[model samples]
Target: MWPIGRSFSSQNLFLCLVICQVVVCMLFVIYRNTQSLEHRLAILTSRWAAREDGFDFPEGPWNVTDSDVVRCSDLINGRFPSEAAINRTIDAIRETVIKDYEFIELTRDCTKFAWERGYYNKPITKEELDFPLAYTILMYRSVHQVEQLLRTIYRPQNIYCIHIDSKSPPLVHIGMERISRCFDNVFIASNLENVYWGTINIVKAERHCQKDLLNRTDVSNWKYLINLTGQEFPLKTNLEIVQILKEFKGQNDIRTLAQPVEEWTYYRHVLEGDTIRQTTLLKTEPPPDKVPVHKGPFFSALARQFVEFLQSDIADKWLEWFNDTKNADESFTQTLASYPNAPGGPGPIGSKAIISRDIVWSSERLRERRPCYGKFVRRVCVHSWRDLVRVSKSIRLFANKFHVEYDGLVLQCLEEAIHNKTHNPPMLTFHFIDDFSSSE
Candidate 1:
């Protein structure tokens, strides 16, 4: 009986030992899982914090804060900050949040304020008193940029025709209409075109604006017609532009290249269908028009006589011939400028006198001197703040491809510079005359 009792006690002790080992293993696993969960939670919290702070983000133009406005005002008033200081501020806000809805509402409110306050109304000086310049602005986006451009170049005597791309967002159309209604000199184009790059639609859009401007009987004071894009900013003041135009003395500034039509010009596009559209490139024969083919940049400033010629039968014939031609915008105007007997043709003034735009092509030389702000699209460089010094010193009346989102400082400084020049006209010194002559 004593031996049996001892065996039962031994078995009970072994069972207790096994149960203790199992409990210890289970506790270790629970502790490790808790630690892992805490680590995961910490990582998620850090990610959210980074996003909220806008770290590592490029600043957007519409992200202007009250402090930024104060700084800009200071700069305009000649409290110039060092380049490094400016860059630091810009970098700090580079990743500022962008809300599309807020941007649209801001545009509407600003337009209303400008209209009520007459912010753009200014007295015309003798230099531009009688000389009216016509402008056609082709815009697809950037409502704020457009408004800034209008305010900067505003003159009661000048007429502006804005053509919003038919494919643009509804907000863009609404903003443009509201802004145009504010001034008698500004009007939206009745005929809007769906513009495609390197397509005839661009030329058609310009022609529509020109025709609308010419048909308006309410205003008859315009003398020169300058075509512009939304990305272009005027480097010269209105008075300066007027003086330069007067120097031309009735000649047009249209660049042209007298050369045979390249093979690439023969490429054509075929649309798949009306609703679900797909474009297919097809190589076609050279333009049927027997006239010599010429190529040039799309932008120009033409005299009223030349603009009228574009509305004549001869211009219509060239337009029809180039309807199917690829990259017609580059050739249509050039062909007209090179045509015999045309107002801006190879006449007494010569084609060089007609060339005015300061376009920076994406050549090896340009890449070496001035690096592009953003990636090149279609081989064109988008101007950034880095190019501000070079562009400001340029002799051209206007520069192309400035994006507010890319670098707001360039445009901001440019506006201040222009305003300063206007308010305090420079003295007429011999050096000024020499600089003016060299620019011409």
Candidate 2:
């Protein structure tokens, strides 16, 4: 009996040992799995933390911040689109395109495939985006198209201006109305005065536009002006334009003509000599607030303060001169803006100015008023696919006259140019706020 009991005890001890070994193995596995999961969680947390901060990005004309604007301008010049760009664009589309919505939106609306189908192969550099505006004018007499074009480019803020001669058809007014419907940030000339080629009318109209700009207090809040005509179109997508401008906003010197009124006289008169003759006439009444005198170009992005100056009392003499003078169109704004120490503060404000003077002049030398020396006579037409491609490459925010029927073409071109690759490249660096990881 003692031997049997001893055997049972030994057997029981062996069973207990086996059970303990199994438990140990299972515990080891559980511990390892928990450690592995913890490591994975830590890694994910670290990655998220890094992203909360930004990666180093390329500098200039790019920002993740919301409040930024970009400014670039080109005179209307008709240059065709590039083949390689079209192909790459189409390739990207094919890779991403799916479903009927994509077909209509990406293919039909954008017209990216049309160019890849070998429509025309004109090379367009970033520097050569001046043609669409010229073509839009020659084809369409509509001044409202300029506003549409500005919409395609992305800027934190935007203002568009359109200038039409008194000679422009009644449809011009209709076009202006159409523009008003589409864009709220546009300025259309309220006074439709006759613009004799060599007479003061052109300058008068320009002054009127400037006066409107100067009168506004809100316009100054903007960082840039597009100064476009009805015929111009955008080459870069709004996203791209916004990105580029955001990167370069404060850094670039492309502010509109917002120089203080006092500076205008000094630089224009003493330094540039754009104005040789200045007639100083004292106003007996000291006219109520300054009249807007000849400012350059119907379409310009004036700085807010500069515009205010144009509306100030200092601009009174200049405006009086513009309204009364005959050949003032030729030199009124230029002269008054440049006169040294003229009563007004230096006038033309802004970092740079681009003048678009592509109009066909008749053989009749402008004997009646000051002659326009360099006006391209051939009217512009943007009917064909080639025309659309060419105009899209212009990269100008504003353009001139387009026929009413060409609105579809203009809109299409504008949309495509905005979406192009070169216009919106990825930023080199990224940024994140501190405590992003710690809080999580």
User: Which is the leading candidate under lDDT?
Assistant: 1
Best by TM-score: 1
lDDT assessment of candidate 1: 0.67
| TM-score for each predicted model, relative to the true structure | 0.71, 0.40
- Give the runs in model 1 whose Cα sits over 4 Å from its true position: 1-84, 91-112, 115-118, 121-123, 271-289, 346-355, 364-375, 427-440
Q: Write the per-residue lDDT of candidate 1 for residues 302-404, one digit (tens) a residue.
A: 8888888988888888787777666788888778876666785532333242334656767647454555654455667777655654565555678877777
lDDT of 2 at 136: 13
| Residue lDDT tens for model 2, 1-440 | 11224587777877777899999999999888755632422211111211111211112332122222211111112222344543344354344323222223323422343344222222333322321111111112433333334344423234444556666666655554443334344556556556554344565666566555444454444433334444545443333333333333232212123332432322222112322332343324432244333334344333344444445565566655444333444344344444344433332223233322222124435423323222333433333232332343332333443432322433444344344333433222221111211321
RMSD of 2: 18.6
The lDDT values for all models are 0.67, 0.37
Clashes in predicted model 2? 68
Worst 10 residues of 1 by lDDT: 43-52
